[model samples]
Target: MSPLELHTRALELAAGVIGTVQPEQLVLPTPCSGWDLRRLLEHMVGQQRGFAAAARGAAPDPALFRDVPVHGDPAGAFRRSAEELTAAFTSASAGAAEPRLRLPEIRDGEPFRLRHAIGFQLLDTLVHTWDVAAALGVPAGTAAAVDRDEPLAAALLDAAGLVPAGPADRAPGRAFRERHEAADGAGPFDRALALLGRDPAWAPPAR
Candidate 1:
């Protein structure tokens, strides 16, 4: 699958899992510290909208990246945001001669190559899908077809390797925390998650 296809699939998988969330489940804690499932979903939708805006060359607006509150039907909100993002990316990819995107959320609104930026979004999508699934009590590997997504996992791991691993880079408020060590005999998804600062063994707290 193309990068876009992989990203779309990941987002679809996230939407499917999110669709199962009952209103009560929104209060469940996720892998992201200090955020409940509702907040995580909001963040996911916000990022999708923000990235879609960037793809359309929208001017930098902090509000664009802020968590979008989901009112009715959180699953529908997520699916719509995903579609908008994919559509914007498709248009930008085809229409632009240079294809440079202005990403305000990163590096003071630096312009990034469209293809590279898509990779970043893909990594974000893969990790957040895991986050929501984990919050819902889905086994780590069972979320998003860990085995079938090996290619995406491998690609994300490689992309993560390009990120700086210094203390400052992993400091509090950073996009990712410090990398964790993967377990022995871990598969590609687990290894990639660990490399990207998520614990493959992470589970929701017992009620």
Candidate 2:
């Protein structure tokens, strides 16, 4: 599938998990260190808004990357943001050939290829969906609402090749942790998550 299609699938999966979140569950810890379900959702929404802005060639603003308040309805907020993001990418895809958009959230002065940027979002969306599922006590093998998509996982693993597995991965505020080894016999999705520094075995701490 194209990066845009992959990204849309990831967003749809994320929406499924977000839709199941109860108000009381917002405080549950997620795989993202120091982030609860609420904070993770907030970050997801903020990231979508930021990327949507970038797709439209908007000026970079720090606020664009900062977490937006969920204001009680995480699912509604995420759905609206996802719609905006998908629309932005759809519109941008029709414009000038091979436009490289500035991604201030990733780097203050760097422009990334449109396809590569969408790939980045795809990677993030998949991992974040897993993060939310883990927080909700879902087992590793069942991260998505639908049946597992091995091909999608493989595609994400390939897209993850774009990430630098260097000291930069350890930088403060970096989206991923340093690359680490995946367990022996891990499947494509688990391997992909591990490559991005997420332990497929990660679970919420015992309450």
Candidate 3:
């Protein structure tokens, strides 16, 4: 699948997970270390907006990159942001030999190819979707979320070949952590999650 198609699938999966979140579940701890459900949602929304802006060849609005205020309906707010992000990527894909995208957070504001940028976003969305699901106690294969992530993971692996190694390659804040050791018989999806720094067996803290 094309990067855009993969991104759309990733967003759809994320939206499904977000829609299932109960308001009281917002404070639940996720596998993202210090982030709770609310903070994770905020970061997801922010990245959607930030990447959308980057697709337009404009600097991401500093405010949008900050914590998103999920006042009233968090799901509604996220849906709007996802829609805007999809539109921006679609617009950038039109009539462009290659997209000239800039992400200020990476490589000191260097530009990246559109495919690579979309791959980064795809990886983020898929992994975070699992984070939210696991926090909510959604079973591993529930709604085929893991199934959806597998191909997206493969796509990222393919896209990675296109990115040249640079200083950021050796940077401390790499996109994924060292791959965790999985138990015997772990499936591809679980292995992929581990590769991306997520523990497949992670669950929310007991009350």
> Runs in model 1 with CA error above 4 Å?
96-98, 141-144
Tens-place lDDT per residue, model 3, 49-147, is: 888888888863455466676765668878998999899999999964987788766665688888888987876777778788888888474325545
TM-score of 3: 0.83
What root-mean-square deviation over C-alphas does model 3 reach?
A: 3.3
lDDT tens digits, residues 56-124, model 1? 998767689889988757898888889999999999878638487777766667788887778778777
Mark the regions of model 3 whose C-alpha exceeds 4 Å error after superposition.
Answer: 60-64, 148-150, 156-176, 182-185
- Number of the candidate with higher TM-score, 1 or 2: 2
Each candidate: RMSD: 1.9, 2.0, 3.3
**Model 2: lDDT of residue 56:** 88
By TM-score, the candidates rank as 2, 1, 3
Candidates in order have lDDT scores of 0.79, 0.80, 0.74
Candidate 2 yields a Cα-based lDDT of: 0.80
Residue 195, candidate 3: C-alpha displacement in angstroms = 2.0
* All candidates in order of lDDT, best leading: 2, 1, 3
